[model samples]
Target: MNSGLSKRKAFLQSQKNQGHRITFGFAGIADFRSFIGQEYIAGMLKAASDYDLNFINFAGAIKYSFFDDIDFIARYFKTFRFMKKPLIDGLVTWTSSFCELTDVKRVEDTFNSIKPLPMVDIGYLDLPGIPSVRIDNEYSISILMKHLVIDHKYRKFAFIGSETSSPHLERLKCYGQELQKYGIQELENSVFLLKEMNSADIAAAVNKMLSCHDIRDKKEIHCIVTPSDLIASSVIEELDKHGISVPKDVAVTGFNNQYSGVFARSPVTTMNLEYFKRGYAAVELLIDRIMAPKEHFDTLLVPTSLLIRQSCGCFEQSILEAAEAISNSEEPAFSLSTKEDFRPFILEKLRQIFPNLNKNKLLTLADSIFDDIQGQKKESEILRYFQSLLQDLRKEGLFVNSEVQQKLTLLRKTILSFLPDPQKNQMENIFHQLRILASVFIEYDTIAPREDSYLMNTLSQIAINFASAKSGRQIQDVLRYQLGEMGIPGIILSLSENMTSDLGSTSLELILPEPPADIQKKLPFKITDPAFIPKFFFPQGRRYSFMVEILHHEDKYFGFTFLEIGNPNISIYDTVRTLLSNALNTVYLREGRSKKRTMLLTGEELKGILNLSEDDSSEVHNGLKASEITGYLLEHLSEMTDLDKMARELSVSKSHLVRRAKELTGYTIQTMHEKLKIEQAKKLLQVESLKLGEIASRLGFQNQNYFSSVFKKNTGMSPRAWAKRYLH
Candidate 1:
């Protein structure tokens, strides 16, 4: 029975042991506090929890003094040791930069002294029994060099790195080895080791390199290999500030394929080291080692790959070659094929002559050329011919003069014209080919002819003739013939300038008798007012004025027009004056009593009637006519006595005199004082708060009651009400 109990107890103990959990601590979490890091940490925790493991994460920021603080490291290590358990699985230390100041011996010593249960270093340190996961700096640097040499064909190279890191050391070693393989000497002076390079420091370093007499004299420094993409971008910026161009003056290659490199002025060519995968794999390896400490330790080497971009000027050639091959092939393959079989051979040949050609654009051009040649000739024969031509061109070199562009343009036009139904397609394919070629070979410029040329004149004349015809059917006929001659099948005239400024009021106008069916489907603007003009002007503040008259004759409509060009404000005044003068001339030309002229008829007559001389006639005409007319009437008030009776006798409305009086004298005609019996009546009524009956009696009213009622009706109030409100 005791033996049976012992077996049961042992079984229970085994179950408890199986339930045991391992905890992990992550150091320097602050350094890895980005979106990528957060995701990685979450994954790490999930994995640990699944494996019945516990984790204790640590974050020690090395922002300022903490960078060189040995005490901080010692204290953190002590705390970790205290928290560690006898059954602790293992510890992993993750850091971005190297931890050891001196050598691997110092790193090992530091680890042994700490004695944090069982620990591992996962950064840039080689601890004795600890497993590590780090970037394959040597392989990555080699890949970078290959991109620079084989891809970009850059010879003069400079490397930027941090001196206090294992990655830099490994990268330097590999960089030297690769240079030796290419029969190039690795110069010590070319390598720039920055302790903590900021913008100013980076700029200074780049300027020094660029200004160095030896480097400038030897050959143009074509490429710079950097340890970090961020550093490489900074170098590009600095070079630009100094008036030096990237990829043009110097190409740049960087390690660590970062997103920033993609968005930089020149996208950098970088190595993809699989940083996150490396970290995860490192954790898994460290955990396994902890579970079985006596197990044989192993190191994992992650492979690196290249992401080529403008900075290195490498991948463009490959794209060009692929395009060329596709173009030249008889039966063009659609599926992606092997890089070797589909390499950009045409681009490679082109680069032999145009060494500075951008790889991406070159590849695009080659593809276009390939498409152009496809199905046009025997594949084998064309290939042979292309090869021989490329060889000859390379020997002669690409010497593109102005005539070359013109010839290319002519060739493109000819080819487009020969295509099946060229008008229908507009030779879109041919245009694309020409554009690609121009973009690669020519500097930035507009290939289309300017608008002020003979071509534009011909187009304008054709459009004008079509618009001016009387019959809609006639207009269409004229347009079809004219446009067909010019090789234009269809055109929609949206807007046009009728005449040049300085044409004055004699502008040519185009009238569309029958607008296209499509235009009828769209919304229309105001088209009715006879005097309404469509304004046209030059860009540099020259105003051109014109009015269009739509003529309807039979079933056709034509545009009749006149234009005036001058200063806007001046022209408006001049136009009004001209109309008034013409009216006056018409009145003078009339010869009958039925003409029924007034004293205020002529501008000159009105000026004389106002007693103003001829010198002021223009000012009187341009100024308010109503004021001058009122002044003339006031001057002739005695002659025009009995205004109400005179107004009726003159055949003018009473309201007309009131309105004209207000406009000229700034008062109603009733308010005008004529020094008559009404003035004496008003003076007698100006007593303080006088009763209406008393005021009426004093004003010599025949009946006080009738006078009070008349006064009240005229003033819109009783005398008492007015006196109460306004009397002092």
Candidate 2:
């Protein structure tokens, strides 16, 4: 059995063991610099590696491109020679140029010289003795021509050849043979060889072909076929520069069903080579060869199918016909049509634009649009309707861009113009402009369009503000900016010092205003106990003052407004209540609702819910009070006087210490103590030679066990886990 096959089989069998591990090696002529080759091979190898099947590419040792120097080739093989016996379960080659064997004789001679390793050629497998997976290039190209000639009735064809590669050679030959069977002669001059031609060279070639006297006079080329869609696109660009439109003037077809080709202004009708699946299959075949060394080395030729689109003039007639019908309609013009009539038409047009759209999503979008526009008059009235429609379109997996939007807008306008109208033509025009503008707004509003880095920055800013000293102001500022970015209204958070005054008391009472009615009704609000406390005695019928009010600016609702701490006292109860109140008020204001009734919780009420004793002197009830505990913990944490230790020393359970500390200091004892420990650990880790186990042991673990467990639990993972994952 070949070494390559032996290695792959070992790898696969190891994977089945649930604990077995193995690595497969991939060898190619080109260096691992080309994005296409690198990405494809990397993806396959990574998958194999993830499945406990290790994959190593020979890319580091051998250049991806064909080696002209004999020394380079010798070094490449020599690198492999040093690898242990059965180094690769299977050797997978992408292009024939990468391997030592250029022919059958080379295959036998080379493997005979080296230790036996199974080899699988991806495309160029001349040796029937080796396993391979390749596309039926000849058959695929012939099918493409047959479709053009028989179905599309396209004749006077031209061929674009990638003369440097074998696949192109086979395609060109098959194209000529197929055309000949139909009593067609492929003119020698009609064939253009694109060998290392840049954009300018390609453009020149296109110009020459178009300007050819014989071709021009005789109209010899009605349709041109290229070996790849990228080349077809270049041809299209060149022809477009000469004002010769594709499909309309000279129909064009290309191979490789790339999405880029379909998204081209004129979608290209190309062959679906199923590259992803082919890559997947290749790996599977390589794995198979590794496991079964004696199995016959078979060539597996994958089939290709055509994906017809506008580039080949396939859907041109339907689109033109639809456009003409709309232009000729007798209905009064409007900007948007009734959802009932508009959705189906839009769906049809969109299907033409993107053939891959799911039928279910198309129907769902139509339903959503209909629901949105049921009785809405103004376009903005159904703003959510349009938003929902856009979402549905997204679910279809069609790339929505400016161009798609423009086309959709036009289609919507046409449909709306046909629907019944009051002002008729004038209303239609006005609504049309509004719908376009609204679509643009909605497009920009989509979070999907933003890059990850920008979103991360926004989130980081929010987190920083939430943790700031002047958190109330910071929160308001952050919310304001976020709302603006979201195109919502502005908000303000106010702190009223005189809202609550009780000279003898350690707690302050504050009042928060009700949110707008629209916002309030649409949203629910709840005040937590920690942020608000009933501390000041209120005179009968006297309204208590609060610190926050969420507002709306320009008909848009801003986010939660927070109240600043007053001079009287900022307690855990106050912070919790205030945050909860602010959150509720923000939601209400955004929903445009009025405050119904202010709900207040007394110290007794909070104590009952918290299951705390009324005489618990250590209990802190406000965030301000919590800060005192945090400060104490920070100061005494390294003295073996940690919160938990203190709790144990004081003959109290850790839970009791946490509750009492939170009530008295406004911060959780656990939170404060954890921060202190982490700080100390960082300092110790930086200076000490202690192993993680020793460090954990020193941290007061029963052994290193509890210390490492707590360290990781507080942080993210265990101390040893973290060290192994990130320290190095």
Candidate 3:
């Protein structure tokens, strides 16, 4: 905040009885679930300043349906419930997201009740009750049109955009107005709006455009205009598929100059709408109106700049060039102050750059920037400080000549505000302050996507490691090394023995950051147990950990990954679990399941289940090791039909046998016996002499229908169907 606001806050603090606490309701899409919409957050924060804020986070346009009255009513009611808070004094909202997809009459009642809360809308003006801060589409589009007509001498063009609502219509209208002024009328087939927001939609639109026009002819459509860089990049990609070079075959330009526009092989020349300024202005307008209710509402217009890039045939041009030139262009003959003087000053400067940023978060950002400077001299460090601030500022808006002047004025006013008393001569110091900040910052920004190759490589390496993992110890070592390479400090892999069915009693099978002593003990529990969940928030440490079920092909191959506990990057964690799940699936299919058949029971239960006779010896009480038990079963495989006699011979319970079998092998004893019997039945089913009744009797089923039902349930087909399909 500027010194004026600081002074006002100080004064307000002193007036305890007046209750100067201001709560500004910021309504828009800052919800992390709608990750694509966070571009609004930067602008919202700048305009919000130091006020106590409440974010409604309503993405009604994207979340709610337009036609269903019941859906509209329920969601609108739920979203607007924030308005019921008695202390909310004013509202700043993205009207386009609010009004476009919702019934105005349904939402009208909510706004009407809060008519006294001075409100300002951003992005669109469709909402009737509130004043808005919008992009100057006519002025913005006119710049591009004039540039194309005069400088490039282009004639025919196509406008590609959505026809959704007011904002979209405004851009289209601006295009028409510019064409009218130049005496260039659009051809009947020049407009393209596929009414979808995907790259495929834009590709289809471009294909349709090409089908109608002959790009080979010089008089045909020479350029494609779009609503956003996303559409423009998609159109370029689609055009590339058809072997058409951008600007060579058809020039392309887009609005919003967003990061997604970088995919265009030829960079898209786009319009910068200064969304931060718009966001700031909306808050200011709302605050001003709240302080003093005006007889009339005002619409604030934030300016837009044209970025000349490769797609419009401007290969030599750059991003934010003017702001950058001033950074190094001017050699400051004088410095501000000493190290002590600069540190506090630098801290305050960042507060302005990241206005409305959380206090702790703002401090954290300052620490990072300061660390980069590393105690340099005030002269160079202050310039670095100003350069960083300007770079952040340019993200909000392209600082052109006029926009630069507005910024200078803001700094000058702020400087004058907090002075207890000052002479006119202090104007020189203020000018010096403005000059330092006026310097531009130029640096190439890199967007290293996380959903790129590094993640894929990490998964591939993990799978390769798992393939070579012959034992439990190797599985641990492979996992630790593989995940560590991906900057993952911690991991926990949970897999149930019986993954072929529903994962009920699964637990933390493997966990890092522990004593090796804990690894030997079994920690199996139900999946519903709290121990399965890892902690999510740990601000004191850089490390994080999250656990997600690994689902590959089916829940049968289920597991979970916990990485860097308490990390906020949910997207990365989600992707890692999925990759791990897939890698595990690949390894499982290649090497097959662990092939373990150890009875999951105590020594007593295994002995009781086996019903071993006196002649079996005292060693019968030994644990049900997979090798020992499977070897014994193979030895006496044929004489195991007399269940009661076997129980009587060893004085072991029959129920214990059934329970132990399922727990260890993921099958009931009866089912295990049935599986063995099915192998015999398959041989009999193929025999020309053995009837269906004889087959059922041989499998220990008294009725043929009972055998058929069990066969269908277990094998997903009747005995006849199974025999016909597999035998043939």
Instruction: Write candidate 1's Cα lDDT for 413-508 as tens digits.
Output: 333332344331543444444434443333212111211122445645654564455443454466446634443323222111121111111112
Q: Model 1 — TM-score against the truth? A: 0.39
- Per-prediction TM-score: 0.39, 0.43, 0.43
Candidate 3 root-mean-square deviation in Å: 22.7
For candidate 2, the clash count comes to 75
Which candidate achieves the best lDDT against the true structure?
3
Cand. 1 Cα-lDDT: 0.46
Clashes of 1: 11
Question: Candidate 3 on 566-619: residue-level lDDT in tens?
Answer: 323224444454445555555555556634221122234334434433333333
Models sorted by TM-score, best on top: 3, 2, 1
CA-lDDT, candidates in order: 0.46, 0.51, 0.55
Query: How good is model 2 by TM-score?
Result: 0.43
Q: Count the backbone clashes (under 3 Å) in each candidate.
A: 11, 75, 9
Write one digit per residue (lDDT tens) for candidate 2, span 561-613: 32321211112112222333344344444444442211122344334433445
